[model samples]
Target: MGQPLAPPPVAGDLSDRLVATDVWTDGMLAEHGIPVVDVPLVTFGGGIGSFVTADYLRICGVPTSAIRVLTPLETPWQSYEYLTTVSQIPRTERLRSDSASTPDNIWGFPSYALREGLQGDLKQLWNVLVEPIWANYYTPRAGAAFTAMEKEMHRIRYPEMVVRGQVRMVRRRAGGGYFTILTPPQGAAPTRRIAYRSQWVHVAVGYPGLKFLDDLQEYRKQTNDYGSVVNAYEPHEHVYEKLRAKPGVVLVRGGGIVASRVLQRLIDDRDRFRLDTQIVHLFRTYTATPHGTGILKRRKGADGWAYQGFNYPKSVWGGQLKQQVRKTEGAERARLYKEMGGTNTPVRRDWQEQLSRGRAQGWYRVMIGQIDRMTKTGELVEVAVASDQGPQLGSFDAVVDCTGLEADIREHRVLADLLDHSGAGRNPVGRLDVERTFEVRGTRNGNGRIYASGSATLGGYFPGVDTFLGLQIAAQEIADDLHAQGFGSKLGPGRSTSQWWKWFRNQQI
Candidate 1:
């Protein structure tokens, strides 16, 4: 996590358009006498945002081979999978989409749960309650959608290479554009720097990787149980595997979306695998008075929200509150955001019913407090909770924190270097602050146009841009920028009937 890397010695310089037009790749170009000037549309986080942008670019004739999706092969939904399929994935977990959130089509294929109702059953119910048309926004099967994206990867053969090295930094090239440096696997010295010089640089480095608390990091710094105590997002196969072997008390922290999903996942395990798992949910907010009005029980959690809102009520999305938030500053803005919401979704009634049933059954319960300390017992964990009643001690066979994901760009040294040397500055929201076009707002002397999108840009002008729709919107804006710069033409109204039919025929139902 240092300054942007110094420019690689330019042996045989080349242009970006040449990189795009070539059947010869970076590997092949070097094989010949030509140098591979990496294409401009290099997307760092090759998740949905990258996929949509790459897909649009490809069909619009921006040959898939030119776009390099530089990311770990794990799909964008890995964080999501751990919560939904708490035990094993049930194909039946219907998506809660409205009529327009289908993954099959980006721009036009806006089908909802109800649209799938024409097919049949509990699914139809899913459509009406979850996927009805013009209904509230819903979350689709993030995993399945990501799987579908991988297929698109194969179809387009997007970019001939995905260098395994992690980017440490991206700096402006001596001549123009930007120069990205990567840290290869442990022992590779020769190819330490994989230079990507482009006219336009997209820093779509999604949400920063998860960064735990000082205590957690301190524990990790001191001992090795860091693996035993998992960050809610990372790989924790052992936690579940352990639960499978023995039925014991598992403590779950946080009341956010992940917490709720994790709760259901535990319940799913109980029903599917017949594991009589006991769970305790730790919530910071005690329902003194419901936070919502009438039917909407707007109960606040922790620092904000007395009722249901992502972090704030929907009114914040469309009403005067958004403008008010715009005028706020410093602690006021943070307080305003706090007053709105964090990442918690409303307690979906279905999941709520399941938890309620579990509580009635005596298998599930809740704790109103926060973790004050932790110590390892022989085969369990000793947790001290700071409750309103007083300090209380509890023991758990395991602890799963449903705290959401919040990563810093510096988690990877290469990206850290990019920020240090490339002149990139964070936006007001504390994530990558980019211009309207999604380009990172680097210093005036900063190399090439480095833009960021997806969760990283949530602190930007648009709200909910971290969602799938947001990714697509960012891609469209980025693509428009590239098009204006003469990268290529975007496919729109001018399509022939045959081509339109071809695009339509390829959609998912």
Candidate 2:
């Protein structure tokens, strides 16, 4: 019989062009004319989490050439700044982040409070000193945080290691290590995709993406109107802009820091322009008083919003709660996370006063409910909410959803790929599971170790895994783990002190 004819080459056949399986070898890829760049480590999601990790590694003497950062952002804080500004925290406004959680300085020395004090802001200094007692905990300005991160980024020469692109997925290589496939922007690179082969991989993709409720998404889809119902994370400056231009009523959803900021902005506009603006704040779980499972662990709440100095109990950063969480596993760890997790905002006196005045003046109202449905009524939106009192209907100019839950990690292509193809499992809390070292469990491919941090790895040993301080802590743990694997020098006190001195001196590595 005649030899069977070979099948024709298919268009966009990634089997030869991409590393889709653990069986893909460097020789196989090279034979197909695909380029492979080898590096000791590669970090995806070059946000503050990646910056902090790179910062620690650089301090430990890791060269720029040995590491690669795959990110689509031009700067580390671009995504953060976008969220903060849209949620009413302009550059000059204070962030909800604590003063001590300085992402730029790993040692947390010369905290934001101290920096403000040095600049003649004695009031902020006092506030920090008496925080959670006589006064609310003080936080740093958004601009200060961004500027500090920028300085550290340059100092570490992080930009030199950044490869701008969207990370498609990570696949295990046959010989060893892992191949991280990145889809570079069109016209930016010669190839449609680029692969980075590395022994160590760190994933810090931040929040998967801001989640808009199903109802809001549906309303937008059916009506094709993007103006009326908006998420706090997106660019909704027009919502406030139009409100400032004329009188209007806005329904603010969720009871987190973003909600507080949104309310403050509305009240500020009302007070400044003397415009008749009404705000209706909605909460899913209304906290009424000091509530908790234990006396010493009580959280303060009132007027529908729970108040806390920070996101998690400070004890989670250290002390008994930290130990309690670290030792727990599976369901127990998830339960502990639930006990401490809830939407809470710092008790800022100014916003509180604004809210109080608003309530007394009948311009602001609070309702405990979930949005049942929403329909566009001309330029306004008619909302039906299932409240504790019962079903209620309201019409508002705009609805701002401030619920900042990271959409399921699977929403991101890379994270979804990790779960489906890399044998990575989710913790009981439904976030990426990791070991005490922040090493992603079950993704060990030969000598390569996959580590994760930031919001995606929240269910690991740390409760504050998404915060700035949490990122720093995660970085330290990952750095230590890498050091143990003989990748970089261990950051003992002596080395840390010397490196800190260089930082203080404004010396570059």
Candidate 3:
């Protein structure tokens, strides 16, 4: 061995006192050399979820000093933009969100389409007006959304509330409330960890981590080769760059939105560079017809793809599905999620046309199968698949896995600690359980409460918990709950209108 490996800094950073105690005391923290930073509320993740909650609270008249945002990300959109970009959705590309799903503006009156129309892009306005029927649904460009969020971030003074650090764990306090352990970057603090004592804690960590297919994970582990196989969510520009350099066979996996974007990017590159790249698509389950529980709830499916305008049915936002989920409990809610959820992509005209052309040109091929094994063969990866036709094996220059996220919330350290120590429970779908008000069930410590939103709290009452609008709805519920606890002012009609004007004028709060 080169040298003996050094032990992790867990002992020094997260003291034995902090780790052993389910309920923390200030005295114990003091003894452990942990400095306590007191704030009324603490929200971790520092992503869009935290930003939206902070925005809603600020609009409801909560001061920045009363709230603290603990996160490693500098901006709310940092992680989101990175994911989108790696998945081939750059600033110029459109996001698969509704025009009204504005994370920056809660009112959503001057929607993306309206704003675009004001800026002389009348096509988006027309597209939204007669969408899905006359034309495909209109979506906002990624740049516009990020720019709006930046404006709102400055207006709300979000930076003031930000404490740059990675949150290690959260524990219930002795008297009431919670103590969150934050491990600041190296040399940023006197100690390795700082304790945040707060009455309420909000968890908005999106997904635990990326989920690699079993076969792909095994291949990577064996060969230690990340270049040949890649997840669509990660930075895999080399895949496309290699294609541009020379024509090659590529396998496009999954049938989700990211899969569509990846395919679109591949086809776009072929068209632009005049390359002879052959595209092979693999779908585990081929959808040849429409699918749903009922005619009213049916989603259009064809050509091995389920087409939807948004992530979930629009009804889940504020309609029948919302009410149905809110009223149900346990298995019924799980059943609803199963019926509504699956791999799907929106129908985009450009991609459809490009795919249709590729089909005619005999460069694009679709295979219905699950990978039995993946092996690196020379410069290419060989994949053995169990398909509808029978067993098949193929070799390609690259394999792009565009499957879903990590299902288990316990993969994240903080969430796992919550389950083990903070008395948090899992919902039917195996994520953090939360009430209608977004308060994490079973995590209440005295007068303090822990609220969770975003992907970690999916499968709760909200079916649209992962979307921008869904996050806003969660923030509203949280703000209302805080108001009930006499923390923030109520967001009444008068206040809403006044705040809307302030947002319009870009006035700092």
The 0-to-1 C-alpha lDDT of every candidate, in the order given, reads: 0.58, 0.87, 0.91
lDDT of 1 by residue, 1-509 (tens): 12222233443333343232212233332432333346765766655666677766665567654566666545544444443454233335644233344333455353433334544534544534742233334544545455555555555555353555565455565456654544456565444335665656566666667667554565446555754456566556677777888887888777666566667777877788889789877777655444544454355433221335344454444357645655654556665555455445554656767877987898887778777877777666777889877898988877887666577756755456556656676655676666667766763333346666777666665445665555666676777777776776755676434344555555321
lDDT tens string, model 3, 1-509?
12322333543466554586687777677666678999999999999999999999999999999999999998999999988888898999999998999999998879999999999989888988999799988889999999999999999999999999999999999899999999999989988889999999999988788877788889999989999899888889999999999889999999999999999999989988999999999999899899888988788999899998888888899999999999989999999999988989999889889988988999999999899999988899999999999999999999999986675788899999999999999999999999999999998999999999999988998889988999999999999999999998999999999999999999999
Q: What is the lDDT of residue 122 in candidate 2?
A: 94
Candidate 2, overall lDDT?
A: 0.87
> What does the lDDT come to for candidate 3?
0.91
Which portions of model 1 show Cα errors greater than 4 Å? 1-38, 74-99, 102-104, 108-115, 118-139, 154-165, 182-190, 214-228, 272-276, 287-336, 443-447, 490-492, 495-500, 507-509
Backbone clashes counted, model 1: 34
lDDT of 2 at 151: 89
RMSD of each: 6.9, 2.7, 4.0
Cα lDDT tens digits, model 2, 1-509, are: 12322222432123523434444567655544446788999999999999999999999999999999999999999998887888889899988788889999999988999989999999988998888799988889999999998888899999999999998888888767898887788878766667789999999999997777788889989999898888888889899888988889999999999898888888888988898998998999998888889987788888887888788888888778888899999889999998998889889899889999999999999999899999988888999999999999999999998886679999988899889788899998898999999998999988999999999998878888989999999999999999998988988889999999999887988
Off by over 4 Å in 2: 1-13, 16-20
TM-score of each: 0.76, 0.95, 0.97
